[model samples]
Target: MSQKPSKSTAPEAENAAATRGTRLFLGLSCFLAGAAMMIIEICAYRLLAPFFGNSVYTWTALIGVILIAFSAGGYLGGHLADRKMALDLLGWLLSGSAVLTFFIPALHTVFAAGLSAQGLIAGPVIISLLLFAVPGILLGAVSPAAVRFYSLTLKDTHVGAAAGTISMLGSLGSFVGTFLSGFFLLSTFGVRSIFFGTAALLLVLAVAAFLLAKNTLRQQAPVILSGLFAFFMSWMTAPKPKPGVIFEHESFYHHIEVSERTDGDVTRRVLQLDSTMEGGMDAKTGDLILPYQQYWKLALLREPAKVGSALFIGAGAFGMPENVSREFPEAAVDVVEIDPQVIEVGRKFFKLDEHPRVKAHAGDARRYLLQSGGKKWDMIFGDAYNGIRQIPPHLATQEFYQQIADHLEPKGVFIMNIIAAITGPKAELTSGMLATVRKVFPHVEVFAVGYRRDETQNVILMASREDLKPLIQDRYVQQGSWQESLIKTHVPKGTVPHASYVFTDDHNPVDAIIARGLLE
Candidate 1:
């Protein structure tokens, strides 16, 4: 109390101000670091989808691997930050993650295709580890590093305040990042462009961190140069487009592609959703080219004596609707497809035209059926699927089959295209689907496309209110005449293994059933 403390000199005061400024930048880095982590996580699924499918298994593997990376990074990062300058560590981490993210667009296919060759069960796990682990670890380290740096800048050392503020900033950034990626970034800019943007943001943060570490602009120039160089190299390494692919896109739903291939006299244009061949037609005949679709011709032959109107769910390539419009020129046909881009692709490459009789609606098939008030069709077809292995669960339940039945005329028919095994280890999906459909429509029949009961193949299931067993007795219908050859593929109801359960909306395990089927 005898003497007052001396006031700080101008340089010391200026330095104190600089430290406060650096602390603010440190908080900004934490926010961005959180944003970067989420962006990478969301986009990572799209990276794997074109190959491994957007299955629940793929989702589980990615989430698990990323959490593991974050945990390890947090532990190691705290140790490093205690021993070294956190701002310096954060700078290095941001730079490293930036470089790795830069390379993702060019190199993801190589990793995905390689490990996916290992088969479905273990492939996604191994590939996710290889492709996502390091970037996640590096980005994960940023939080603790920033935490320590912020603590060092304070005089009283309020550890709880430092952590809470940093965590809140990161959490807020996470909320922003999730909405940004899901709502805007992916749908607008696409996945690869988002990755490029994320990389650039990280590079900027890296530079800011170094500059705040008392580094000269000259000292940080090389990092700027290296980031530039890496992007250029990565751009050069991007894979070339595949042959026969006329158009391609990353829709919110699937990686859709259209390609043309000729076999002998037939030139076929095919619409592929992910790895599944959902639609195709002959170039000249404009007729359906794939065999499964050929099964749809039974629509006109079997149930309705005359077709005036038809409703087709899941307009793959618009093949069936186009077929119906051509079959009965006066018939009004409505095709419902979930992906508008797929509908766009149908128009662009699949010859989906402006026919007055054919109307294409972009929306979910189930909702469309629910909204229909007293509208009935002579024939209703369900040609939708999630992939080769499974149908969309909501589309396969007893309630959905009831909707199909309710929307049909008294003599109308419902046809479903199913890819499943008949009587072997992988037969659960087929048994469950058949059992569920039979509950709503008493007359049920099936035709395995390849006529092999034990193998997984396209099984065309037919249901109607009218008795269909009589068709087998009709000579012309079964005479190997018009649709008689299709009769040869008939799967008698007794041959189908009885399932212990039926699929309902609340209890549907269609995806899980397929996953287990794949393992077997």
Candidate 2:
């Protein structure tokens, strides 16, 4: 206290304090950036879902393209950081990303209409690349640049450790982002809100960047004006028009829409989003009508009492639930669908509101089943996928099927739809899936819908604990009111060929399966 501190010692101490603060700040920023990137990926899926029905091909293409884009951004960001580690550049980059984030919702309507005209392959591929590439590249640039800037500000001691700490935080943030997008953001905010929320977070990031660059900030006027312009332009624009009756709403997790032919005095309402037509309902009478009606007819082979309670995964258009409720009026029906907007659409467009016997739970089918506390069912229907893309991997897992097996009653039936290339070599996929089910269920059956026995394209799989051979015997002679009135009038054929292959979580190459069918 008596001796005044040396000038050299005082400056070093101050530098150490400043360095510690900057490192903490950089760690926080990196965390935010990682989360933002993941959110972008999740939202991209939501964006693509309407045009493509969550098919294996669609999921593969989307994810593969995103990974490629991220790789490209990594290269580009590293190059940019080498040239300049300025905090000003970092702020602008975040600001630019925010601008793009804000515009995505507005752009999606236009992009979808364009896809409809040009086709998803020719249109969506190009559109997604153009719209998303730059922002992705800019985002990729953030982590490297942040580390570089931190290196400049920090005292030379433990520079590598500090950079590593920031990197660790970023990775942790990414993990958090993946879960948050699915479990929290999508399920709570709806699609539009997620986009807007992402923009707000980016705005906060930009502000932080600006503060860090206070001493280095160049002409702030232009940056402020540019940001204002981007936001205004994005907010002022309206959604693009479509020819069909487009009904859009945010159901916590997804942007659900139902579009139909308005001019025709048709009784059917097409319940669709992206490419998956959840189901259809009679526009006039609100009666449930969908391809699933044919699937339900498979139950005709089972003992009537054995089919008492039913659990339907993916309660789209609520057609199956409504039909099941009508058939087994006393049955306790449990319907699990992830999208809340889909449920709302079911109520408004599909008369789900009037159906008192069915209870709809808005959550992922797998998580719900695992956590459903030993609730068993006589018939568990897994109608979880559609379109040329968008199939969720978790639902198609070996574990999920095992859970289905554990939850099913002794004489229960488990059915799921697999879009096969009904033609050529693709038939093996249907065969493979049948084989997979037979691995556990003892008996497996197939019903080729929208195609002839001779025609190969899309097929439905019906598996059972007991032999379907007995049901095959009664299929022709046995008569129920629904069987005689409904299925016999439509399918006419009492039985279809069963495929010999089984699909497991590890080996199910459904995309290649569809591609073989399509190419063949």
Candidate 3:
């Protein structure tokens, strides 16, 4: 109590406290900035899915463009740090990034529609760059700037150690962000809400950063104004359904939309997943309007006892399964649709819950089949499609067909509805699928549902261990209607040449094939 500390020592202690505060602030800033960057990247996929489709090509474009943006950001950030490593500058960067990010949802549909018209490869790349490149650059700059601040704040600490620690924290934050956003955010919060939440977090980070730097209100005015402008603009410009769209939802698997259109005398309700027409039904009669639905009727011609139980891999609009339940009251029908939301939509809009004989199971078709154990089906229908009428890669593989064969009864028929052209580059998908299915089933035949040679059409592939001609001939005689005429007109009489590539669990180029087909 007798002696007083020296002025120099007291000042040194104060400096130490101030440095510690700066380090803490910068560390938290870097961590959060990194987290925000990754969250936006993951959300970008969902945002783009409605237009570009969530495919390998879309992801490739996103990842590649984001990496390039990061590299440029890091380079520029390092250069700026060497010249003027100020917290206020970092604050501006974060604030600007937050503003741009907030605008993403508002601009998505507009940009997507405009760019997608260019084709898939160029479309996603250009759109990703337009939507995310600026923010990625701004966020990437945060890391190097953070390193500079840490080095300056902790003069006693080794520069290399400080840099390593800061970078590691950023990476750790990224890891957490990736898992949290993918697992929790997408499921818990809607896509637009997630973007809004991300922007809010960034805004908070920017404010804290600017306050720590002791910035004046006047100096912070522009950032505040920009953020406000972005928020209001985004709120005003958020996407809305087109005039006739009665309902729309962002499911974990797809951007589903239901719309109504009126013809001369009848109205039709259509179910669209992303950009592909999944199914349609007559509004008044509830009759399936898609031609593929009519073809599924052939399953009735399989073994009489075999037709007692059947499975449908995809349940779009529940059209075929509901029809089966209604037409064959004795038959037990099980439908597996991967998206639960789609099932909900089906029940709410398509009357999926009204059928007692049809049981809806929500899960991957392949996984459901594998887990079914000894449960066999008389007829298995595979109508699962992804993107713009492309079969899911896993469901189109040789191993998956083997699973189908195992789950089928002795004379069970496997009817698959796939979209591809009959004769052109697009026919590769048809040939490849046929080749894969042939590996497991002894007899296979192709029927062009639309009978279009130049345009992409729904090509039905029917395979069975037993000959199907007898069933077709029998049904032809019984029905003696359009079903007979369709078979004769659209069904291919000769075998198709084997495609250059076979789809397998290990190697599947279905996305690339579809992209080329769509581009052409």
Residue by residue across 182-264, what tens digits does model 1's lDDT show?
87777677677888899999999998888777778887887888788878877887667779988878877777888998988
Residue-level lDDT of model 3, residues 163-221, one tens digit each, is 89889989988988999888788767778888888998898888878988899888888
Best by lDDT: 3
Candidate 2 lDDT, 1-520, residue by residue in tens: 4998687998889878866776677777788878988887776777776664455544555666667777787776667877976677777778888778777767775666566444434445665676677677777777777777677775446669757876788899899988999778776776766877787788777877777667434555555566666666766765554556568765544556676653365566786665556677777765655554557657756767335788999876777778788878888888999877677777777778787989999888988988998889888888876544435656765667888999998888887876664434545565556556667777766666664554544466777778776665456643665545433323222233355444566766655554444445
Candidate numbers sorted by lDDT from highest down: 3, 1, 2
TM-scores for the candidates: 0.92, 0.76, 0.94
Q: Itemize residue pairs with steric clashes in candidate 1.
A: none
Model 3, residue 55: distance off in Å is: 1.4
Alpha-carbon local distance difference test for all models: 0.82, 0.69, 0.82
Of 1 and 3, the candidate ahead on TM-score is 3
| Candidate number of the best TM-score | 3
